[model samples]
Target: MHQIKSKLLLTGAAVIVAFSFGLNANAARMDMVDVSNNNGYMSTAEYVSMRNEFGVKAVTVKISEGGTYKDPYAASNIANVQAAGLYINGYHFARYATKAQAIAEADFAGQTAKAAGLPVGAVLATDVESQEANNQTKTTNDRNNTAFMQEIAKFGYRSDIYTSGSWANNKMTIKGKTGWIASYPYVATGKNWYSTNHAWQWSSTAKFRISYGGFDVSQLNSTYYTADQKSSVKPTDPSAVHQNNQTANKHQQANSSAKWVKESKTYTLKTAVKLRTGASTSSSVITTLPAETTVKTDQAIIQGGYRWVRQPRFSGYGYLATGPANNTLEYVKISVSNTYYTVKSGDSWWSIAQRNGLSMYSLAHQNGKSIYSTIYPGNKLQIN
Candidate 1:
């Protein structure tokens, strides 16, 4: 009887452990879809139909080849996909080394994205395919390719390195913001390419029935935009300038009473407030304000010698200074949390927030910066 009882107890424990493992395995199965046509061969109607029918979440279009700028179709495709409500990102097929060549590719991609009015959702990716016939070029291609991504980041976009799961882990040391792994079945068995990635593309053929070949697979999807995210997607058309101006005026009216603080002691002011060619702070006279200035508890004080205030109410704490503040500071009591994240190459505000289980708004608020705010390796985030 003692032997029988012991046997029964062991059986029960085994069953319980098996059931727990099964549940966890099921939970780890994530649904992901990819929109990649390697040769710039996808049609516009096909792309649009896929987005509409399958609810595809993100699209990766090619912008360069052999370390040189090529293709006009990439811009139109990116625009059409974005207009249809899907997120858009770009990739470069790297096969070159000279810094000039890399910079050219980066500039070309940036110009195309700017023209299309598509804010890159991920870093402008560097796609390294092993089948290319140039072994000598391939030897130095990895380092040159990384340099290309860093150049692109200087243009205010993220850099996501793309390669097979095995190659990226074994051969590449991508120190950009993030890694974009292209492993099918969304599983990394031996050496996962994107071990430190914030997002992963797990499959190629899964579909939302978006015309048989397309599907949407993003973690977050919605039409509503917070003021900060909205500001990043400002209209580029000249005729819409008046409407944009009016909207800007309205935002100013809404946030006119908010306080302004500088992140740096010396900051440049753009003649205009857009991402391109706006005023920047010179190295001179970047100083902090006296403690008696009376900043609101919710407001951000810009440090680093730059003068700009974050408009938390209007733009969700990501908008940089348009100009100086017009009102006296008022303090508000709010609960705050200190958050820590290890910065990877190609990390953006969105990716960091998503990884650490925080909302973009909360992250920006705690750090007192905007969505476009620059963060480097080993930066600590404070969430208020």
Candidate 2:
């Protein structure tokens, strides 16, 4: 079967079943699952759910494709899976037709896998079901496939070959290497179809009620995770993922050097505005402040073609734009304070001036009244 995948972008879903354990004739075998960016960002809870709800013993994440594309979610997925107490490995989609090309692609895949934190000596399988390989002669395909796996071996990783059962039986002869054969039966009961291979990918449309979509799944034999292989283990709290994110956000905030003018002011938003992490339109948004919301700002800065105002927060500063750099078409501005007040029974010029931040003489003069003028509650006075 030809498995088409986007060369650089995340697409589809597949699971590689893997586990590392000592070789024992009586050890109960476990299944492997594969994931790529198409699985989205898996949380530790989700990984735990997969383990508890569906019995996913181990995971193999797609690490890289071709020579230049590294799967964006590979590192995070590896970490989450490990944090959830599952063994982890990595795989790369291969596109090489010659020995030299295989070596080059293997080098790229090996380095990318390492950078993504796949433990050294974990199974690094080359997914060789691309259409480019189907067009090459069997000799060419086998020779270069061996070259690819051999090159990755130099990087201290155990190697395997992932291909369709038909390809393994017909088009390619990856002899002596562990095989991960993909063959979707009418019903995937986790039964091993290719008995000689180390792993059997029994279904590409396997779905569990706990997961949102279908996935490719495999049934792995003990050799897929032999005693010699290094397996991923939980090194920190799974919640540390969120902590790292918070730290990165702090780092991003610290990177800005905008000079803010401090002034306590309140403004009413004229339109919905984005609260950002930084003083730029391109910065990541924290939230959206709805129209007519009143917000207090302790500082403001002009940057990135906008007037950004800082709303002091206990965690850090959240910024929103007042308007464009030219200060036209404003989204928010200083709320108008009362300019006129009605005289109360006990109100005096001095009391009015103190409340309005004005001098007694200025308040009385603005209101056309003497400082000692007797006023009733209904008399209007210009407090400004």
Candidate 3:
């Protein structure tokens, strides 16, 4: 599941509105449809068709990618799926190489899901079958996976891991974790081949005699529908779900504003950056602009610990992060001057000189100031 942002996926909205409306936990089998950007913009009709024709009772949508990309269609697809009367869940494409990175990506996934309107208690699985992830040791992967899921728990969501059967068995251990395994069988069997796992992706080209492109289909068991299984792969009572939903709703309402600064300028991405619907990192991602890509911005904003620019779009505008405010690690380069560095808070003369590979005196002399002269944030100093 090394799917990029362009080919991400999602689930239905109605699943959470009334979890018991059309779902039975003790049923022998249930089907779930996972969708993303590759499926194109879906309609409520499509979700209805999925539910009625294919018996898809639940959906697991791709809500975010790595630590920065949020699927732009997630919000719309989630709404449509809900209207079609199917349960909804979420997944994230994992790209973290370290425990810290895993925690950050988990926070990003949690925030993206909440912002996209996924109700609390939804299972937010981490897709951990990326090549870079597989290259690492199993110990490292398991440790990081634990960190990712723990962070997701903090946002009032249950967690799972999505990976191949072989990887789930050998590359990492899901003994204590909820496992959603992917393994296409030679023959179409309603049974989960990986019986020990909670959910089994049985077909990549599944069709229930409906006229549509082949979709990845999976068999979900009773454990998949449980609302509050923080650990273990077994089903549990969801008595605390309502309280969690209320608490999470309060948290979202309190911290959902972005700070804006109107300014028009051209800039270049120093690193790959996600273009989002708003200035916040939790906002839906439109697309990713690779490093060195030049774009024109009509405004700028600071939110979620990073500075972002508002790039005008055909429909409205998209936000791209310039970088974090407290550090010199800028991802987007201001095009005003290539040979200058803008002073940011917490930056000292020596720190600035060190970052520019210059002596403090040399930097001070170039800027026509004493080495001991105090520098302030937003002051541009010549570096070349």
- Say which candidate scores most in TM-score: 3
What is the Cα-based TM-score of model 1? 0.40
lDDT of each: 0.41, 0.63, 0.64
In candidate 2, which residue ranges exceed 4 Å CA deviation? 1-30, 189-191, 226-384
RMSD to the hidden true structure, all candidates: 24.1, 24.0, 19.6
lDDT of 3 at 68: 82
Residue 46's C-alpha lDDT in candidate 1? Answer: 59
lDDT of 2 by residue, 266-328 (tens): 778876787889875557889888888888777766444345788988899898877533223
Ranking of predictions according to lDDT: 3, 2, 1
**What is the C-alpha local distance difference test score of candidate 2?**
0.63
Error of 3 at 36 (Å): 0.6
* TM-score for candidate 2, residues paired by index: 0.51
- Candidate 1 residue-wise lDDT, 59-131, digit = tens: 6666665544565567666666555444456667665445566667677766655664446334366665322
State the TM-score for model 3.
Answer: 0.52
Per-residue lDDT tens digits for candidate 3, residues 1-384, read 111121112322233323232333222233677877545577888877665544466778889988788898898877887777666778998988799999999999999998998776677889886544644788999999999998898876778888876577577787733688775433432233565666776544343333243355666644454342222211222333333223322332342243365555667777677788876544787888888998887766544444567788899988876653222225656465446789999998778864553446557777999666899999999864
